[model samples]
Target: MPRPARTTPSRRALLGSAAVLSLALGGLAACSTSEETQAAAQSTAGGSSTYPLTLTSPFGETTLEEKPEKVAVVSSVDLDIALSLGVVPVISPLYGEAELDPWETTALEGLGESDLTTYDSTDGVDYEAIAAAAPDVILATSGWTLDEDYEQLSKIAPIVSFQGADGLTGMTWAERTAEAGKALDLAAKAQEVVDGVAAKFEAAAAAHPEFAGRTYTYAVIHPEQITYESYDGSDTSFFERLGFTLPAAASRFSAGNQAVSRENVDVLDADVLLVGYPFGDEGLLTRSALESDALFQQVPAVAGKHYAVVDDLVASPLAYPTPLSEVWVLDQLVPVLATAVAGS
Candidate 1:
């Protein structure tokens, strides 16, 4: 479904939109706050919030009776957003073995958080654990089940949920960040964080003038079919931010999903073909099927080796593109993209 033009959200309405699976499908942790975190949470000038701000989610409206000093985040995307704004939540998704994106881990360390009171979200929201942290607000902006769990969660504190977001795909990174900022009472810092990441993309784009006006398609190489990410959705803003464009034909589908069979693989042809794989052998196995297909082999970019196949870890930026992920993958992606566009 097409998204409506955004209005400045009222006390009960929301202003922004969601990210991808890395956040929605990835690990969920509920961390704790500390004195160092309090110090780090100080916003730059113009980023303060007055108390009793009312916020809205799809489930219901609630007023943040005060600046939320202790937040509980349901997704890593929101965790990244909170960390970027320099506020440490009291509860977040459990990182487990995969841990957090380097940017976030580093941020946590910088904030003097040596340990986290983590909980596995795979079983679902650990309301007991969240309550244990005694949070003032919950950041479920990118949560898949925020609707069903909103009431239960609100019993603990106000929920700043994502509004107008597509199911699962949630809000764009920018939208998520802005919403998190508004909820945290650090709107100014949120924009500052967004602007900082934009400048990074701008620098990458400026350094590589060839990327300007170039056409590209980003997709995941699944086994039976190929799913394309939209330039307007699925964090294709990562490419657009890097001075690339997604051709109308290359866009193939919308709402950040919609699979195309190998027979129709020609739609992906562009100046640069970027495909990502799952973390393990599954991605390689699927990639083999895609590359072996006669139709895929004939695509100009693929035929000329003007493409880049990245592992899932490196592709999270494409999926979510949060302030943390964006910075983490910039150096890694630019060189790969540069080679693809070299088109030798």
Candidate 2:
């Protein structure tokens, strides 16, 4: 028999829409005093409460009401995190190639979305759609923040923007996840999920001895022949958390070089090639996309068939916050790589 679907809370049942919107947008006109703000900030750490609570984010500080039910997530990753916590929001936008192309619907299966309004990040958000949903809390980042847009979103509800404190811009996915969780008073649960992923990664690493000595490269390739490789201590926080060894060839590039040209493909000289396939064919990397390309065909990985195509599931930045993503990676990607190495 198939496994039962996980129980989740309804968007409307999660929080009071009007009150949540007020707290998120800093529009608590009813309680404008500093004492009111402090009182509301004191209530949200991890339980169901009506009191307001303050949270420190990668961007700055924002206060949220306890057990916020209606959440509007700007990032799909944030959506996944909220879903994992059993809080389904009114509207959550999709991201990456998996989300945009082929109208990526599989990723959102069981998330309770059916013909909901979608927003384009490139041209800013769809205010009309957001207003129609009547969301109470809006979760986004300074990276995508526009002053006018922010002001407009604030008008609709309370908005939580993820920014880094001090020198920290919340660049890492883990930090951002933690910040969001804290804002919702879900820190312990988030940490537990993260720790579970770490444990699973350790087991997978132990089971695959071939991966021990091998250096691997993780690259995000675009149709334009530009490749963006992962770097240590960079924005690729999931990889960092999993403790995967990166290819030495990536060292030649700078820290922020998320995209690379065809000329740079030669520099990815690792024993194994792990390419992210968020768009197009899901198994492009494992197959022969590299061989078809004259520049990449010469790489030792392609020649030796040492490439592994990662699924769009765990391969996305959006899904990085969920333990389910970890299961998909270690259970699916690791064995595929092991088999490829053995055959090659």
Candidate 3:
């Protein structure tokens, strides 16, 4: 039997302030707050009841005695969330590809190139580099932060790492937005951002009733290996929220993604297919090869031309969903789907 259909719940209802903080602080021991830390927390806590916030992550609980002015983000989504919440970090690391994604480019607009420092963190977090940025608080909420990395970063500033069992991926975009809001003391604004994007999804669904009840799958083509990896509904939560459904054939995989050889390409039978590739000529060539293959052509989405090719920049934001990235994806994704399912 196929896996049961996944349910998308409201992050706010599921992770209330107390629950979220408790889950985050579950494994860590309580420690005494220093005088300097207490002073900073009191000053930055502003007038809100949630001030002097204590954020729990995989590493431990980090209590912020005050608002963090010079913030540094290890993950792109964290950085984007910070910017969306009107808090620009002193340093924001690149998301694997070694450059800013399209959403980041738009978010960083109006600020000088030097205003936000950028660096590569593909291998691991650079302790010295991030320490040099001198952030009052470090946001590693959506990155691959190991315990040792957290230990070192903590020495520089209070660090907030990923929460829940799935780490970064466990938290929905809404949850991440809410967490960022709480951390930065912009809870109201964060809710506004989440509601706005949700409104956009509702509008898109209403505009394109054709999208309802349709199944879709997103895949990354690896032409050289004659294999393509299919992503789970969690990875395409935004699409699912916009009224699309995931095919059971593609959703049964345990890893939320599965690699299928060319011989099994028929498994990816969906009303719409969203293909992604790395940026540059190599990715283009790979996508082209997959598009031309006789095996892939046999797939329903390919046979009917109901597919869209998304490059790294466009796909990055979706991979790490944020308020800004959600808006960006809807703006680009809705039209593509509309066109793909037009005559069907």
Candidate 4:
């Protein structure tokens, strides 16, 4: 049963940290020199410098008068992608602030650039702050969709909302990055970024052939019996991106573009399972249920102790697709998966 929607201090604090924590644990990573190396080696788009660029955004076609300089990215995910591409916009949302979020401090320490200004979303966005940055174009995403605030942002610059594009709609992190690349006129570069990550997964898979035939399943088991397991092909998820296969039973539940959950968690049967929970709260419920369930204990992964506790924000399709989330995935998840696969 879904937990009652009660707002306690603890609940509110957790809910607030959830977004920040997810940014840390999910796939947000600074653009590494290694990734840059791979990108440099990839085939380029040739000599297309500055021209009238028309980008297909979620809202509509955004025609750039001449290679967008002084851009404003309203989404943290978009901020990460833009930063990764080495193009810092005039204005971007702060991931976490110094007083409120220490994770942001550590995350940006080695990233080498820090000219961004924070926009407090608690009240409406400060249009004057954004205008002060002198952005000619604004890139807004999910939260701003249909919100009156976007209209105010639009008055300052041509705001292209990402909540509407088919390419970005419910896309995985990889797909989202590709879409962002298109917006930046870095389509070829985006393709290379994905190709490079996929290649790493392939190498890890090759090193750990045992996982080759292994079937994996994922879920978020919240307190009070809120269990969500993947239900389809689009649910292949980052685990699938990292070379795991979904069980046949769960294959039929694929939502095509989004991650859909099963009504009954008991239907989740696979060789391996990944459970997620919030950060500060003890993962007592998830741990206890998995440990106590006979069917869960009998799974191949459980018998072999192959099951892992993944951060929901890291694994969730909604959070991880942004450039911000990818960094987290690489740092926290990839290294562990690479080692596990290598040894297994």
Q: Candidate 3 lDDT, tens digit per residue, 1-344?
A: 11111122111111212112101101111222233432333343343426577878777777888876677777666776776765666666542323344565565453322234555553457788888888888877766554557778888888766777776657776788777777766677778778888898998899999999988777654333322334553455687777888787765654523666667767776888777754223332366666787888888788898877764545545554678778887888888888767634
Residue-wise C-alpha lDDT for candidate 1, range 34-140, written one tens digit per residue: 75656655636255666788878767888898877788888777777878888777766652334555577688777776555556664568899889889999988
Give Cα distance to truth, residue 105, candidate 3, Å. Answer: 2.8
- Which runs of model 1 end up more than 4 angstroms from their true locations? 1-32, 41-47, 95-97, 165-170, 231-235, 255-257, 279-285
Q: lDDT of candidate 3 vs native?
A: 0.62
User: Relative to the unseen true structure, what is the C-alpha lDDT of residue 63 in candidate 1, on a scale of 0 to 100?
Assistant: 86
Error of 1 at 66 (Å): 1.6
lDDT of 4 by residue, 1-344 (tens): 12211122111123333223212112222232233332343326322434565654544455566645556666555555555544555655432221212223333443443334555433435578678887766765433332555557656766545544343345555666665565555666666667766666676556656666667766665443434456564545556655577777675554432232333444455666666654324433545655677766665665566567675434442333445444446556755554444434
- Stretches > 4 Å off in candidate 3: 1-49, 94-97, 110-114, 119-123, 223-233, 279-285
Specify the poorest-scoring 10-residue window by lDDT in model 2: 20-29
Looking at candidate 4, the ten consecutive residues that score lowest on lDDT are 3-12
Error of 4 at 259 (Å): 12
Best candidate per lDDT, number? 1
lDDT of 1 at 291: 78
Candidate 2, residue 238: Cα displacement in angstroms equals 4.8
lDDT of 2: 0.50
* Residues 136-159 of candidate 2: C-alpha lDDT, one tens digit per residue: 677664324334466677667666
